[model samples]
Target: MVIRDFDEFCRDITDIYESTLPNGEGQVASYIPQLARVNPDQFAVSLCTVDGQRLSLGDSKVDFSVQSTCKPINYSLALQLHGEHIVHRHVGREPSGRGFNELTLNHDGRPHNPMINAGAIMCCSLLKREGEVNVADRFDLVMDTWRRLGGGTRVKFNNSVYLSERTTADRNFALGYFMREKQAFPTSTDLLETLEFYFQCCSIEVHAEQMAAVAATLANGGICPISGERVFETKTVQHCLSLMYSCGMYDYSGEFAFTIGLPAKSGVAGALMIVVPNVMGICTWSPRLDKLGNSVRGIEFCRRLVATFNFHYDTL
Candidate 1:
């Protein structure tokens, strides 16, 4: 909790994140009008060590949509419920090596991995059980995870954002139907209900501290360091973080894996979270996106943080 190097790293990251913005470049995901109004200049960074030290930088308190990063958390929940062997039958563990919108699945239409849209839909479908009361109950379970992870305060529903995603969600809808076609989805699954839940989950806004805590839970083998509570099963967490390591970044997963050497995930809402086992967990937010649709400043902050802090786990 008291690592001197981490204390200094926080200072540096805070300085960088506080000083940058979207500038005149980078396009927002405006097909959803709710996303269009995000202050392009907003940015934040939050970090926590495995021992529970907290270092907050920039607008780490500012709320932002959870976006695709929700996939792995929900994936963890799915694994906890269904077990690894059953879940693997429906979703592949490999990275898709393309943008998130690409609807094609594996040769068998099994989702390429849980980190992508297709895989996320599949994960959502897997959440639907025969005895489940309704979609809200499932969402409540996810919210319970958020609460235990210290992100409860940051959870806010931007109705407009949800609606906007629904408006432009034809690609996502197509993915669900295509999965259904290939037997990737259950015969009794309700496509629209699943899609709505997925979109709403993506719209849940969380601050960086909550993100850091979530990452720390993964770092600590599924236990929240701050809350001292177990959220998901240990094996399920391992599976989730492993996928984040391989496919968290849509098309840029390869480059990020090669360069960062930390298991991380990014959201279209400009939130990027990284987890280093027993070392630290970090989250960065900058609304300006790079060509890969990742946060430009967020990635820049992580790159600099990794470079300055000696987090190249694989090289060493």
Candidate 2:
């Protein structure tokens, strides 16, 4: 088994989950009204090892919007559809060192990386409607990918959250226009279609239980642990995880890399997906967010997790 003494490991995880419950700092993300109204006190942690061991605590089964946590999956799909060379042509692989939604591009006139809004929007544009008839077909392809990543678990769409995101998407719209102005997007890219697709991707909903399976797929080198199916090429996962490590935490990327030493992505909806390559995948969800837009209880849970286990990349 990937985690020896699985029963003992689960007990340790339970202890960490209980210890993180009293944290009441931070606020729910209010920019999106639907997200703002979520129960901020709710917290959950779920994990799945590469060998298929599983554990969940608190509100692990409760659904929440995926939000920015969708970036790595979308980027992976784009890489699988088009090779790295083609994908990187429009999006760089370096950290942006700015806000996740900053109106900036690299010196080469590309979005810094696929983890940020600009780069994620660029990735949405690359998922061409080839072979797919309409925008819904394209989104169906994305949903299919998410299902594969989640070990064939049912993934749901949140039309309300999608509408909320679309309604409050002025910044993303601005990003699309700015990229078009810079000639960054592919020729004939439908700016409106791309932005709506981005919002739709963000609004997909899943509970921590499902997201842990998704993370485990990445941890197991793009193979779903439960289904034992290869969902992505190994090289695609390597590239995606590398960027998630360096750029996934918004402005806190550097600090998170330095301290946690694990590849993780945090969404404003208070979802944190973490991968311990060749070992396990973890997902923590709590709607109370820090100023940096990370989940307060989720961050605490991760801190405790690493301190208890030698999961840190730098750990000898």
Candidate 3:
């Protein structure tokens, strides 16, 4: 077993979860109406080991939009569809020190990385780019990929969130138009379709239990631990996790990588996915968000997790 004392580990995690409950700091994200309406106090932590052992606590079954957390998944799909050389040609692999929604590109004219809105929009254009598939078919393909990543768990689409995102997507629209103006997208790309696809990807809904399985797939080198399915190539996950470590937490990416020493991605919906490569994958959800948009309780759980266990990369 990857975790020697599984029972004891569960107890420790439970303690951390309980201790984080009293933290009333941070506000729930209000940019999207649907996100703003979610119960801010809802919190959950779920973990799955590479060997498939699982545990969930608090509001484990409650569904929440994946939001920006979908960036890493879509980025992995783009890498699998197109090799690193081609994918990096459109999106750089360095962290953008600006906000996640910043309107900026690298010196090479590509978005800094696929973990930000601009880069994620670029990735959306890459998926199903052959023009053979329609928008619905393309989104269906992404949903299928998400299900495989989560060990065949059901992945739902929240049309309300999707509509809300699209309704309030002036910034994303600006990014799309800016990329188009800069010729950053591939030839014959449909700008509106690409932006809508990006919104749909962000609107994917899964509870912490399912998200833990998704993280575990990445931790197990792109193989879904529960269903034993290969969802992505090992190399694809390697590149994806590298960028996640350096660019996933918006402007706080550097601090997170320095302190946590783990590959993690946080979404405005208060979803945080952490992968302990070759060991386990964890998902923490709490709608209360810090200024950087990370889940407040989720961050606390991670700090307590690494402090209690030798999971940090440096600990090796």
Score every model by TM-score. Answer: 0.94, 0.98, 0.99
In the order shown, the candidates' Cα RMSDs to the true structure are 2.0, 1.1, 0.8
What's model 3's overall lDDT? 0.92
> Model 3: number of clashes?
0
**Mind sharing the TM-score for model 1?**
0.94
What shift in Å separates residue 110 of candidate 3 from its native position after superposition?
1.4
- Candidate 2's error at 11, in angstroms? 0.9
* Tens-digit per-residue lDDT, 1-316, candidate 1: 4466665766776666654543446776666766778888776778887778888866878888889879888898889888988888899999987788796788777989999999998888888576674888898888777777663344666677788888888899999888888888766788889899999889887888888888888888888888778887788878888899899987888888889877889999888888887677788877777788888877676677667667867753
Would you list the rank order by TM-score, best first?
A: 3, 2, 1
Error of 2 at 27 (Å): 0.2
Clashing pairs in 1: none
lDDT score, candidate 1, position 125:
84
User: How many clashes (backbone N, Cα, C below 3 Å) per candidate?
Assistant: 0, 0, 0
Candidate 2 lDDT over 181-205, as tens digits, reads 8999877788999999999999999
Q: Between candidates 1 and 3, which one is better according to TM-score?
A: 3
